[model samples]
Target: MGRWLVLGGTRFLSRAVAAEALARGHEVVCAARGESGAVPEGAALVVVDRDVPGGLDALRGERFDAVVDVARMSYAWVRDALDALAPTAAHWTFVSTVSVYADAAALGQGVDGPLVPRRESGDGATDPEVYGGLKVAGEQAVREAAGDRALVVRAGLICGPGDGSDRFGYWPARFARGGRAVVPDAADQPAQIVDVRDLAAWIVAAGERGLTGTFDASGPRTTLGAVLDEVAAAVGAADLERVPVAPDVLAAAGVGPWAGPSSLPLWLPASHVGIVARDTAPAAAAGLRCRPVADTARAALEHERALGLDRERRAGLSPAEESRLLTHP
Candidate 1:
């Protein structure tokens, strides 16, 4: 067992990483504000606010066998962490997004694909271009500091348990409700996602093995229609009926694709279709395994039920919105 430091382990992917590390007999220390939620049961939480100068001063002298940083939108955070602890860490993993790619219209590109222009300043916003730019810059920083010790995971859409996006979870939840459901007419559009648990497990394993280099981390390529079909099959109610709506009709009706309110989750326009069709062969060849979509659906449905299926969501359509689309489209 090794000593591990997780930069933001209080919630979601970071939390799962911390939990996974602890499960593997590693001593895990999670550095965060401790606001999102508690660290996993066995991991220790070291409260540190990254917005302030010297925020990581508490762990300045500490050394870890492995360090995982899931710094979402901040290049400053990435730089500061590296400056503070990169030298003392044996293995470093930086969680980045596939959006870092420069061209979303280019499908099936591997880790060798071109990246978005680097952005040194991270404003902590949700703008996709800005987000991708920051991640590109962050990846550069991690590689600079850790060199061959770095594992950069350019992740695609991540789903399954502990997911808050409510994107993929929407299908299982809505299907389980048993009614006429509105789906995008994109039968052949590419869709790819990695289950949170699987991604976390792979990250831990990579760190343990001192894996280096970049990899596109996602599930095998499949169509959006197939993904939806699997989700419906795994958890749909007996009376569930899927109603497909054309993209143009959805556009004219003011509903967006991909995520957000009144949108069909996982449905992508042509220009952005490549984002979900990335080549994941390298990641899989490096021992990254993905579970069946049906397993993911069941887990997501369970998470949805825990969060209340009827609750307002950060992504996907509201029931009334879906009903209107079903009837009017």
Candidate 2:
């Protein structure tokens, strides 16, 4: 068994990572503010807020084989983490986002590309900024802080059990209810999403290999309609007809989904998004490849059910809606 430290251990993806590490026979330690609640059952907990004056020093005493930073965004946070961890950890995995890319709609964007630039002040850029310019800045900050030792992974929309906000899962529940597929023209546009479990596995593998540099970690690129079909098929439903509304019409209704806005027509807004390859070659070369989306989707649905996320939805649906949800059963 190896020793592993996970920062931001209470968040969605971080918790998944911690769970995976423990299952792999690793002694995992989680350090985060108790915001999302206590660390996973077996993980040793070190409650330290990132904003604290001596937060970096709090983790200085312990050593581990690797450290996964799952909640870092600011450059200052990156710098502080590396300074404390570089001395002890053999590998450093920093969870990043695809927003680092300048032009995602274009292709051939290998592991390395021109970033969208960083803002010293977090206020300058946010989740709603122009595309992912802010994430680009965060990636740069991590790169500068860890250099050769840093293993940066740029992930797409992450989804799975313990989903927290029930964003992507909203589609599956809605589809299962067998109502009009309230979709916009963007329904046929490009869409990309990564299962949290696959991402967790890949991170652990990358750490074991000591791989460095940035790499795209995402699922296969497909249209939003294709996503609906695949997920429905995964859940044993396949007779529902998906109807699309005019972009403006959808906009007027004001329903924005995780995949896109109500007006986004076809494949997840292909104009701004295009998921070709996961750019996983660097990470793949490090002995990690994303699991098949089919399997990921199936497991994600199972996990969601196990979490009882559909209880309220199940109760809310009428008998007719429930019958429509059952494509064949």
Candidate 3:
């Protein structure tokens, strides 16, 4: 078994990675602020604030067989991690996003696709363009610093348990509620998602094998309608009825596309459709396995049940909004 260092392993994907590493009989050490949550059982936590200069000093001189960095939206943090730990880490995996691609309208592009102009520094904005630019920069930095040992995973819509985004989980939760739910009429829009567990497992396996290269990490291309139908099948209540509302009608009714409040999550605008339809064959061939949508739906529904189905959500339409749309549409 090898020693693994996971940056920001207290929550979500990073946490999943730590858990997977531990399950694989590896010695896991997670370095983070320790505020998000606890590290996985059997893993050691080295609390460090990456936002502070020299925050990673505690981890200096501690060599690791593999290191995973899930630095989101910050180029400086990516650079700092590389400067501090890249040399001592045998394998490095940097979690990046599909938004790094320049043309959101271009379909089926792979790792070699054109990327947004890289920005080594930004004002810490969370907008899509800024976020994508920062990721592009981070990818460049990782490849430049540790190309021989680097694995850049350009992940698409990641959904499953512990997903704070609330995008894909919304469907399962909504379907399980058993009502005339308002769904987007754009059923044919491309939709691709990956289970968090699958992604984390792949990352750990790749590190063990020293997998070096960039890959578009997502599931097979499928339509939004198929995804929704699968979710409904897996978790929908007996009385669940889906009402498809036209895009224009949804817009006029002040419903947002994709995510956030009053939005039909996973329903992307035409311009942004390509991000969900990437060619993930390279990753699939490299041992990135995705679970069935029904399986993901069941897991997500369980998580939603734990969080309470009626609780206010960060994404998806509220009960009042859903009712109004159903009554008017």
lDDT of model 1, residue 302: 91
Q: Give the per-residue lDDT of model 3 (tens digit) for 134-223.
A: 999999999999999999999999999988888888999989888798999988999999999999999999999999999999999999
Candidate 1 Cα lDDT to native: 0.92
What TM-score fits each model?
Answer: 0.98, 0.81, 0.98
Error of 1 at 113 (Å): 1.3
RMSD of each: 0.9, 5.0, 1.0
Off by over 4 Å in 1: 122-124
Instruction: Give candidate 3 regions above 4 Å deviation.
Output: 123-125
Estimate, for each residue in 118-223, the C-alpha lDDT of model 2 and write its tens digit. 6544553335333355456556656766667778787777776656545566555555545455544554666667788878888877777678877788766666
1 versus 2: better TM-score goes to: 1
The local lDDT score (0 to 100) that residue 222 gets in candidate 1 is 97
- lDDT against the true structure, per candidate, is 0.92, 0.64, 0.92
Better of 2 and 3 by lDDT: 3
